[model samples]
Target: MISGALGAAIVATLAILYGRALFTPPSEIDGEPLVAGAARVLYVIDGDTLQIEQQQPTGVVRRRVRLIGIDTPELGRTDAPLKAATADQPFAREAAELLRQLTAEREVRLELDRRRRDRYGRSLAYLYVDKRLVQEELLRRGLAVVDAFPGDSASMAKRLEIAEQDARKHQRGQWQKQ
Candidate 1:
């Protein structure tokens, strides 16, 4: 049985993706109605951010989601002024592009931690595609660093730390010297 919070979240997501129709039978374009913890990727916002589509009772809803447990350098997001204060680092554009290549237009499963949203109101989640974790991929490739401020569990932080360390040692992506 699904928990109440999770059930509500699922309904909310469906409403967001599908619109007021709410589970109006899966159409040809959309494979099926998504239950809780799943959504379709609309686009990649940055290395750690994504825009996802969910079905709603009224219509499809699109939302911005931020990846938990990792922090990649910036590409000057207009909506995030504080982020723009920092200088763009190595591989910033490449990191975002890689994330786009990996997740754009794909369906993903989201795993939430104890906390769901960030102070900035972006949904925090661990996204998976084709059984692979996107956060882990970024870390292993050195496109992102382990920064667990948004994560509730320490295990994710520890795992990301190890992965980032490995990427650094191997001179992966952003870890390489210019």
Candidate 2:
């Protein structure tokens, strides 16, 4: 077995080499404060939701982020909000699959909008993987619908609408039935 001191030294060296990579600030993504609200995506709950962990002065904070301005088909649960079967929505699994591929085990940057939280208190924000906006990509792929919530800004709403239109014209994702 390795000596205790030697093991500890190895761990310390690894931490020193990899610490910043693990706890990257949002601004470090592609530079600029525009990458603010950086966090590690712990996991994805659905196409439009993620569990993210961010460091704060007090400690690390973990919260669910809801991608605003777009809505994917519901993945209903027996005890969920007005619980019912959501499997009926076309491309429901496909959307969730795509979301998982995009966000699982990745670090993401959050850009908050006019509203910061949803009805369930989930952080309402746009997610960026690398420097690419996740919301706009989802809309472009036709995996999401522009379900504008009351708190969503007019400008963002318009942009989502335009993306949806493009997706529709191209017969992408939901626009094309399986």
Candidate 3:
């Protein structure tokens, strides 16, 4: 058993080391229902995900945001913990390249849904660059497919679905006949 003096010393050290984290309030995004703001894109993680930096009172906060209502071809995964590695899908590179070219180090407008974040903790948002929805561009180019969820905006989902259908009909990008 620790002496009273030793136990007090240990507690004091822990409090000094971790007090801020234990007492500071959570960020606004953690509790907000909807988040609408502009952020600078730090990098494109994939066709439908990006890292962005937003200004916060404490400092700049970097976050990963996943686009809503769309899914792009998967990039190859060489490092899997519990499953076999997988190869890139047919249009994976093209999709990722397109997204990178469009959003890298650029300012983007973010409009989040009522369900601000997904199960992965990445913000779910619709990103816009120069007033054009990036998701629609991906769909029109056949780089991504409509992947609407219950949380997605109904009208936007419909629009994305139409864009995807048109791309498919025109045999664009990933929809090209093999």
Best by TM-score: 3
The alpha-carbon lDDT assigned to residue 88 of candidate 3 equals: 92
| TM-score versus the correct structure, for each prediction | 0.70, 0.71, 0.78
lDDT winner, 2 or 3 = 3
Compared with the true structure, model 3 gives a TM-score of 0.78
Strongest candidate by lDDT: 3
State the lDDT of candidate 3 residue by residue for 86-163, as single tens digits: 999988889889888888777889887666678887788999988989999999999999988886788988999999
lDDT of each: 0.78, 0.77, 0.83
Point out the higher-scoring one by lDDT: 1 or 2.
1
| Better candidate by TM-score, 2 or 3 | 3
Q: Quote the positional error of residue 63 for candidate 3 in Å.
A: 1.0
Cα deviation of 85, candidate 2, in Å: 5.2
Q: Rank the candidates by TM-score, best first.
A: 3, 2, 1
| Model 1 worst lDDT run, 10 consecutive residues | 26-35
Can you rank all candidates by lDDT, best first?
Answer: 3, 1, 2
| TM-score pick, better of 1 and 2 | 2
**Can you tell me which runs of candidate 1 are displaced by over 4 Å?**
1-36, 56-59, 77-87
